[model samples]
Structure formats: C-alpha cells, structure tokens
Target: MELRVTNLACARGGLTVLEGVSFTLRPGHALVLRGPNGIGKTTALRTLCGLQPALAGEVSVPPESMAYAAHADGLKATLTVTENLAFWAAVYGTDLVEDALQRMNLDALRDRMAANLSAGQKRRLGLARLLVTGRPIWVLDEPTVSLDAASVALFAGVIRAHLAAGGMALIATHIDLGLDEAEILDLGPFKARSPRDGGPASAFDEAFT
Candidate 1:
C-alpha cells in the first residue's frame, strides 16, 4: 500500500501547527519527518492517524491499512503486557504470536503489568504492538524515545525487516532511525510562516502556477 500526504495542515485552538506538509511513502521504504519542537510533527502524525482533523489539504490512504503509534505510550496500566498485545492483536488483526515477543525481548515481561515496566520497556512494548498489528502502513511518532543502544539496534533491525517485507512507515523523530535508505523530509531550515487563525496555505494552489 502507498500513503501520501499533500499540503496537509492542521489547527489547534486557533493556532496553525503544521503548514503545507507533503510527502509520499510506499512499501519497502520509509519517510522520516524532522523538525524542531512545537513545529507540529506530532500534530501532523495525529492528523494523519485521524486523531485530529486536517483543516486543509489531503491525506490519502486506505483506513484499514494504516496504523498509528503516538509519542505517549498508550498502554493500559492495569493490563499485563501479554494482555495488551492480545487486545491490539484482536483489534488490528495481527498474527505475530511468539515471534514479536521474542523480537522485543518481552517474553519475560509478558505477564508483568504495563504500569510497572520501565520507561524503555514500556516503549518496547508499544513498538511490539506495531509488530502484532497487521497494518501495512505505520505512522510512528518518536518510535525509539526511551530505548537503550541494544534495544535501538533491535528496533532498527525489526524496522529494516519490515521494509524488506514490503511494509511502509512514516516516523517523526529527532534521532537517527538507522534506516540507511529512508527519505528524510527535513522541515527545519524552511522559511515557513506561522499559520494565522485561518490555517496554513495550500501548496497545491501553486502547483498550477
């Protein structure tokens, strides 16, 4: 599947957060969204994931094929790791079984409550949810936030494997994702105007000029 964003913009409380962001992500590849803090990276991901509305422009993808993981590790505190995985598996129709737990080194922590897991472990569990989710396209915001070196390497390996297997991802991160061939959409160093109360301008309008 292919995911495309064209001139995407969003407003929060009358402030324009993202302005005319555009990119295309295809299977076997990835797109890294880079920008300074408060530049709407998270908001952009949220809009793409349907958590927020797109005040302007378009996000084109099959709803069923998209999966989104936010910066906040959205695990239920009372649920066991395994139970959380089961819930996501049932929701997203992922069939990863034991392989995913082994990959994230969570087999031992599987029975532990999500509330007690360390920050890094919780992040890993969140990623493992992605592995079990059968979505073809992933929208990940700060995917490796609290991971250690070894866990980061493991996450990179898993991501590479995913791309090699014809999956696609759009990651918003400040750190290197270790994907050598990934496309980098650097929003920084761009002379972007802060959006007015109405929202940002559309890039498509200039496409005809």
Candidate 2:
C-alpha cells in the first residue's frame, strides 16, 4: 500500500503544533523521522493516524491499510497476553493473533496477565498488537524505547523481514534502528512554535541520503 500526507497540519487548543508537513511512503521502504523532544513527532504520527485532528491538508490511507503504534502501551493490564491478542484479532478481522504472538517470542507469556510483564515485555506486547493487525503501513513511535540490546536486535530482524515481505514503516526514534536502506526525515531546523495560539510550521523536507 502507498501512503501520502500532503500539507498536513495540526493545531492543539488553538495552537498550531505542525503545519505544511508532507511526505510519500511507498511499499517495501522505511522512513525514519528524526527530531528532538516535543518537536511534534508524536503529533505528526497522531495526525497521520487521525487520532489527532489535522487542521489542514490531506492524509490519504485506506481504513484497513494503516496502523499506528504509539509510545505508550496500548494493552489492557488486566487481560492476559493471549486475551489481548484475541481482542485485537477480532477487531482487525484477522486470525493471525497466535501466529503474531509466536513470531514475537511471546507464546510462552500468552497466558500471563499483562500487568505481570516487565516494561520491555510490555513494549514487545504492544508491538505484537500491531503485528496482529496485519496492516501494510505501520507508523511506529519510538518502537525501540526501553528495549535492551537483544530485544533491539530482535526488533531489527522483525522489521527487516517485514520490509522484505513488502511492508512499509514510518518510525520516529532517536536511536539507530539498523535499517540499512531507510530514508531519514530529520525534523530539526524548523523554527519551533509555541503551543499557545499556534503558528504554522515549515514542513520538514530535508531528506537524508
């Protein structure tokens, strides 16, 4: 699936957080969003997913083709891992819940309550949720956060496989994700705007080779 965002803008409480941001995403390629803290990285992802309303511009994506994984854990703490996956599978109209869990090496913890898992385990579980959706375009925010060395390598491997299989990813992260062919979209140098009474921001178009 191909995803495109044209002149995407967002305003929060009458303040413009992002403006005139445009980019095109193609299948089998990954785009890494590089920006410092509070630079509308999360806001951009939210706008792309329609979680945050765009003030102006176009975000074109098929309803089932796009998925967004936020920085926070999206699982219910009371539910077991398997239960969570089952719910996601039902919502996404997919029966790949079990397969996704197994691929993430979470089969052993399938029966364990989400609250009992460690932070990294919870992050993995969150990732597992996205995988179960089987969406072609994944907009991931800080996917490697709180992960140790081994888990980071595991994630890289998973992403590599995903790309090889013709899936696309848009990732916002400060750490190196080990994607060899990824195009970097650095969001720095855009004049920061205060959240109060919003100002239009210049779109970030400085692509890295």
Candidate 3:
C-alpha cells in the first residue's frame, strides 16, 4: 500500500505550523522531510502515524501498517537486549527477534540489560524493534541521534535493505543517510502563515515517554 499525504496540515501546541503539505511514498521508495527545527517535521510524522490528529487534509495508508521511531527510543531499562526485542516481536506477532539482533549487531549484548548498554547501543536496540514489527511503512524522526559515523552508515544500510525489500520510509533528519534513491521534501514552502512560539523545538517533550 502507498502512503499518501494530501494537503496535510500539521499543528503543534494547538496552533497550525505546517499547511498544504503533500506527498506520496510508494513501496520501495523513501521520502525525507526537510526543514529547519520546529517546522513541524515530527508533528507531521506523528500525525501520519496516528499518534495525533491533523488539523486539515487527509492521510491514506493501510491500517496497522506503520512503525514510528522518534527522539524517544522507547527502551525498557530493566529488560535485557534479547528480552526487549522478543517482547516487541510478541507484540507484533513476529519471530524476527534473532534477525533483528544480528542486523543491529546486538548479538554480543543480547544477555545484557538495556540500561547497561551505551547510548548508541540503546539506540540500536530501539531501532531493532522496527524489524520485529513487520510493518510496511517506517515513520522516523531524527533516527540517527547518538549514532557515531560508523553506526550511522550501518543504520543506513539497514534502511536501504528495508527499501529493497518493498518497504517504505518517511524520515525527518538533518544528516545525509546516503540513500540516493530517496526523494526529499522541503517543508519550508508549506510553513503555516499563523504565528507560532518560534522556539527551538519540533514537538511536545515526549522523549523517554
């Protein structure tokens, strides 16, 4: 199924921040969201993922088909690496836990508690959750946070593989992920005319939630 956003308006803090936003991501394709900070990139992604409502316009996608990853990695401090992945696998009714661990290079730390892993490792584990979801669409916001250059390249390869496997991705990031086939959508022209707080934030403080 294709992910379509038509004349989408994204609002944050009860005010419209992005209007007339439109895009369509087909299978095996990627769309990158581009704009300055607080320009509603995360808000748009959240709306597409049904985490929040859209002020206007429409979003069309298959039901229960999206996996969202944002600034919050959604890690359980008490759970071991394997346990965390297996839990998500159970939730999504998939048995790709071992593949997720290997793809994210967490096999060595599988028995370790998430709290014991470093920041980059935690991020990788969080990303591994996507693999178990078996969802067709990935809506990610700044997915490269805390990743070193090598890890960034590693994740990029994972994304490329996902795309190659007929998956779609909608990412909001400032870093170049080296996906030459991915299309870029600049949210600047779609900026809302309404006044905003003009702060250095893109959405509510939902990190670690």
After superposing candidate 3 on the true structure, give the runs of residues whose Cα lies further than 4 Å from its correct spot: 195-209
The root-mean-square deviation over C-alpha atoms between each candidate and the true structure, in angstroms, is 5.6, 6.4, 5.7
lDDT of 3 by residue, 33-115 (tens): 99999888999889888888888899888448999998988988999999999999999999999999999999999999999
The runs of at least 3 residues in candidate 2 whose Cα sits more than 4 Å from the true structure, single-residue gaps closed, are 189-209
Tell me the lDDT of candidate 3.
0.90
| Better candidate number, 2 or 3, judged by TM-score | 3
lDDT winner, 1 or 3:
3
Model 1 worst lDDT window (10 residues): 190-199
Ranking of all predicted structures according to TM-score, beginning with the best and ending with the worst = 3, 2, 1
On the 0 to 100 scale, the lDDT of residue 18 in model 3 is: 88
By summed lDDT, the worst window of 10 consecutive residues in model 3 runs over 200-209
- Against the true structure, candidate 2 reaches a TM-score of 0.87
lDDT of 2 by residue, 35-80 (tens): 7787788877887887767778897885467788887878999999
Model 2's lDDT to the true fold? 0.81
By lDDT, who's the top model here?
Answer: 3
lDDT of 1 by residue, 25-62 (tens): 88899999887887778877788888878878888885
